[model samples]
Target: MIVAEHLTKRFGQKQAVSDVSFTVAPGKVTGFLGPNGAGKSTTMRMIVGLDRPTSGSVSIDGRSYSSLRSPLTEVGVLLDAKAVHTGRSAVNHLRSMAATHGIRRSRVDEVIEITGLTSVARKRAGGFSLGMGQRLGIAAALLGDPHTLILDEPVNGLDPEGVMWVRRFVRHAASEGRAVLLSSHLMSEMALTADHLIILGRGRVLADAPLADIVEQWTTKSVRVRSPRAREIAEAAASDTVSVTSRGNGYLDINGATAAEIGELAAARSLPLHELTPTTGTLEDAYLKLTGDQVEYKTKEVR
Candidate 1:
């Protein structure tokens, strides 16, 4: 398991992370989410000892990453896919990494096959596409079969098949009692893959909770209704606990009321209903709401 206690980092006058504390337990995938400059990468770098924290501590299985006698055997990291040697072949690159930790060539071949890079094993890394580069990076990370994995944007530039593979692979690793810390921009995929989430904004943790809890707390379920008498139906549905909003044309967005309730009300009023659909809150909805005020940069609309 990975544990961070009041983890803070600073770069000269700027604070990159502040008093961040969380546990990435074994047997689960913990997603690290944030805006563009929300300090997600900085924290991950600190966790792996690439950047020292200005204060506080981070440990893997009761030992700091820098103090691990065999770091590769204890933790696997894929912070940057392009950090490899551009002039080396994929096979040679893996070989060099394996040599650092006394890992065998057979294990390298195993990861190459597992990551679907066997065909491109002899190709120079500089010639590989973005997807191939990501695969190679994953292969390197898995070379030692570490008990803990830290991946940043593991599915970037991947095809649908590759993305699904990563989802399944990470879950399988967690099932085997590995600690998994993942970061990604794809909210849909994160919803499907992560069991827990650590949300950061402007160098501080905004939320650290289960996926379901975050979605339920940050967004509300709503019912969508379309009718010629939408205004009328909305008037009838509106109450102390429910809110109805016009969504243009003959559509109404009703919150705090179920589809059944709205349908029954419309039926009792003899109102003609074209459509009545219930929609649940999604991860994207919750993420946008949680980070709405924490965005570091705003893009103005082109009028």
Candidate 2:
């Protein structure tokens, strides 16, 4: 388990992270999400003792990372896959990392096979592709068989098959009671892999809740309606409490009303409805709504 209490970070005059607090417990995958420069990377660095927090504290399993007697066996980290030595082979790199902790050579080979690097185990690190580099980083992280895993964009350069493998592997690790903290820009993947979410915006904790609760609290569920008289239905559904938008081509998106409500309104108005489908709130929708005001950079409308 990882606990962060009132964590804050500063770079000269600017504050990168401000009084953020969250817990990543064992047996569940917790996703850390944020927009560009929202301090997600900075916070992760502090957790692993790479960067110092200006205030407050972070601990893994009730002990600070620096205080851990065997840091590798206690927490696994993959902050930067490209930070490896270019001269060493994949197998040699893992072996060197293992040697520092007195890990057996068998364990080094185990991670290489586990990460599917057996084919290129002897290849120089600089010669590997982005996907291969990510695999090597994961291999090194697993070399220690740590109880807690912290990964940042583990699927960044992976193929679809590699992505699915990571999803399953993280879930399986959590099932074995390991604490898993993951960060990713891919909302769809997070929706599938994460049991809980910790959202950051402008260096502050915007939300910390279960995936379902965050979606329910921040997003408005919508209903999709298809009909020949789409404009008429939309006009009728528009109200102070309801919102309706035309999608063109005989489709309307309705919010603040359920499928049953839409169907009843269509029936009462004698408007034949071909489809009335309710869409559950998605993680992307909730994230955008909550961080809409917090985004530091905004794109101008083309028009």
Candidate 3:
């Protein structure tokens, strides 16, 4: 498990992260999400000892990252896919990383095939494409079979197949009781992959909870009603607590209520209803609403 308490970072006069605290538990995938300039990269950097925090502390398991005797075996990190030597072959690079941790060559070969790097094993790192480089980086991370994994944008340049493979791989790893933390800009993918979420805004944690809880708490549930007496329904339902709006001719949108309530309201008035569909909020909806006021750069509307 990874635990961070009162984590804060400052660069001269600017504060990048402030009193941020969160936990990435074992046997689960925790997704890190935030808008641009929300200090996600800085937080990840601090976790692996890349950037020293101005105050507070973070630990993997029970010790700091620098205190670990064998850091690679305890936690595998892929913060930058391009950190490898450009002149080295993919196979040689993995071998070199393995040499530091006393890992065997068979393990190196195993990760190569696991990450689908056999075709480019002998190819120089500089010649690999963006997707291939990502695969190679993943191979190095998996070389030691670490108990914890931290990947930033692992599927950034992957194709559909590669993306699916990564999704399944992370799920399988978490099932084996490893702590996994990843950050991505793809909400649709994150919704399908992550079991929990840690959302950041303005260098502070806005939410940290299960994916379902985040969606339920941050979004509004609504019912769509269609009938000849739509206007009548709207007039009856309109109040300080409930909201009703007419969508053109025969449709009424109802909020702050349930389908059963709307149906009972229509039945009491002897109104014939054609449709009554309830829509639950999704992860994307919750994210947009939660971070709506926290965006730093707002786009101007084109007239």
Best by TM-score: 1
Between which residue pairs do clashes occur in model 2? none
Residue 78 lDDT in candidate 1: 98
Please give, for residues 1-303, the per-residue lDDT of candidate 3 as tens digits. 999999999999999999999999999999999998788999999999999999999999979999999988889899889999999999999999999999999999999999999998999999999999999888887888999999999998999999999999999999999999989989999999999999999899999999999999998999999998788888887889899888888988899888999889889998889999998888999999989998876899899
Query: Candidate 2 on 1-303: residue-level lDDT in tens?
Result: 999999999999989999999999999999999998899999999998999999999999999999998888889899999989999999999999999999999999999999999999999999999999999999988999999999999999999999999999999999999999999999999999999999999999999999999999988889999999998899889999999988889988998999998899999999999989998878999999989999887889898
Model 2 scores a C-alpha lDDT of 0.95
Task: Show model 1 residue runs off by greater than 4 Å.
Answer: 227-229, 248-250, 272-274
Better of 1 and 2 by lDDT: 1
lDDT at residue 40 of model 1 (Cα atoms):
95
For model 2, what is the alpha-carbon lDDT of residue 111?
93
TM-score of 2: 0.94
lDDT of each: 0.95, 0.95, 0.93
* Decreasing lDDT order of the candidates: 1, 2, 3
* Alpha carbon lDDT at 57, candidate 3: 95
The segments of candidate 2 whose C-alpha lies over 4 angstroms from its true place after superposition are 297-303
TM-scores of all candidate predictions against the true structure: 0.94, 0.94, 0.93
